[model samples]
Target chain A: EPEVTQTPSHQVTQMGQEVILRCVPISNHLYFYWYRQILGQKVEFLVSFYNNEISEKSEIFDDQFSVERPDGSNFTLKIRSTKLEDSAMYFCASSKKTETQYFGPGTRLLVL
Target chain B: AQRVTQPEKLLSVFKGAPVELKCNYSYSGSPELFWYVQYSRQRLQLLLRHISRESIKGFTADLNKGETSFHLKKPFAQEEDSAMYYCAFRSYNTDKLIFGTGTRLQVFP
Candidate 1:
């Protein structure tokens, strides 16, 4: 089966530095999403994208965070300035329909 | 605020024993419910959705409107059933998934 795939399975970056987490959603899927899970915490929604624009976002998705579908296949989350709290497992998900979403293996990002 | 709760951090069961992972949600309107599972060293994958009402891998979950819960249950679990299970919710119109803290199921042989 086709799966959502992310690049840079793990990343370590200094605080205040910019970081870009890339994801290639399942082919033919229309909606894309980003979620994060802190250690020992629940997974939290960050943002969702459709039609080249963000469809919905949570309060946790602040100015520092931005998502882009730079190409037909790539969905990228850019953190302009990373904070220590930004360290977490970031997951990318995609769906052809609204309800059933497929998730990627996730990118473990560490902002030291 | 919308929330999904998985009260148990860990649930231990011997092989062939029944297993149930409790999940509850606080949503005023009806929301779609889902269960995702992640085995050791693997990515998270969908296990069941209350909407489908189909049993996959011998696991089933019922959406109890009265109790505001969607608990996952399996009659007999195998040692291979050990994994981290997460319960999730999404409003009807949007696609963002709100997830619970998750419960780790250890089915011992």
Candidate 2:
């Protein structure tokens, strides 16, 4: 079955540096989303993207976070300034419809 | 606000025993419920959705509107069934999914 794919399975970055997590959602899917799970915490929604624009975002998705669909196949999340608390497993998910999202393997981000 | 609650953080069962992972939700409107699983060293994936009402991998869940719960159950579980399970729900107005804290199931031989 076709699945969502993410690049840089693991990443380590300086606290103040910028980081971009990349994801390629299923080709035919229309809606895309980003979620993060802190170690030993529940997965939390970050943002949702559709039609090249952000559809919804959580309070945690503040000024530092931005999502882009730079190309037809790539969905990227950029953090302007990484904070220690930002370290978590970031998951990318997509669905043809609004329900039943398929998730990627996730990119583990560590901001030291 | 919408929320999902998975009561048990960890559950262990011997092989061939029945297993049930409890999940409860607080949503006023009609909800869309789902069970997602992540096996060791694997990505999180969908196990089943309540809307379909189909059993997957010998697991089935019944949506109880009265109790506002969707508990996943499996009879005579096998060792391979061990994994981390998350109960998730999405409200009708939004596409975002609110996930529970998750329950880790360990089936020992």
Candidate 3:
């Protein structure tokens, strides 16, 4: 089965540095999302994208966060500056319609 | 505001035993419920959704709107059923999903 794929399975960055996480959702899916899970915590929604625009975002997705579909096949999340608290496992997901979301293996981000 | 709640952090069952994972929600509008499973070293995947009203892999869940609950159940637990299960709630207003803390089911053979 076709699944969502994310690059840089694990990332380490200095505090205040910028990092861009990339994802390639299922080719035919229309809706894309970014969610993060703090260690031993529930997964939290960050943002949703459709038609090259953000549909909705959570409070955690503040000024430092931005999402882009720079090209047809890629969906990327950029954090302008990283903080110690920002370290988490980020998962990218997509759904054929708007119901069942298929998640990627997740990218673990560690801030130093 | 919408929230999904999975009260149990861990549950264990032996082979051939029955298992039920409880989930509850708080949402004003109509809600869609889903059960997702993440096995060790595997991506989180959907197990089943209430809308389908169908069983998959001997597992089933019923959406009880009156009780604000959607609990996943299985008749005969198998070793392969061991996984981390998350209950998720999505409102029609938005496609974003709110997930519960999750329940780790350990099925011993």
Q: Pairing residues by index, what is the TM-score of model 2?
A: 0.99
Per-residue lDDT of candidate 3, residues B34-94 (tens digit): 9999999899999999999989899999999999999999999999999999999999888
Candidate 1 per-residue lDDT, tens place, B1-109, comes to 8899999999999999999999999998988999999999788899999999999999999999899999999999999999999999988877889899999999999
Worst 10 residues of 1 chain A by lDDT: A94-103
For model 1, name the residue pairs that clash: none
Residues A1-112, model 2: lDDT tens digits: 8999998899999999999999999999999999999999999999999999999999999999999999799999999999999999999999987767999999999999
Q: Write the per-residue lDDT of candidate 2 for residues B51-93, one digit (tens) a residue.
A: 9999999999999999999999999889999999999999988
Shift of residue A100 alpha carbon in model 1, Å: 0.9
- For model 1, residues A1-112, the per-residue Cα lDDT tens digits are 8889999899999999999999999999999999999988988999999999999999999999999999798999999999999999999999987768999999999999
| After superposition, candidate 2 runs with Cα above 4 Å error | none
Model 3 misses residue B45 by how many Å? 0.3
Better of 2 and 3 by TM-score: 2
Colliding pairs, model 3: none
Q: What order do candidates take by DockQ, descending?
A: 3, 1, 2
Query: Could you give candidate 3's per-residue lDDT for residues A1-109 as a string of tens digits?
Result: 8989999999999999999999999999999999999999999999999888998999999999999999899999999999999999999999877768999999999
Model 3: interface root-mean-square deviation in Å: 0.5
For all the predictions, what are the DockQ values?
0.91, 0.90, 0.93
Could you arrange the candidates by TM-score from highest to lowest? 2, 1, 3
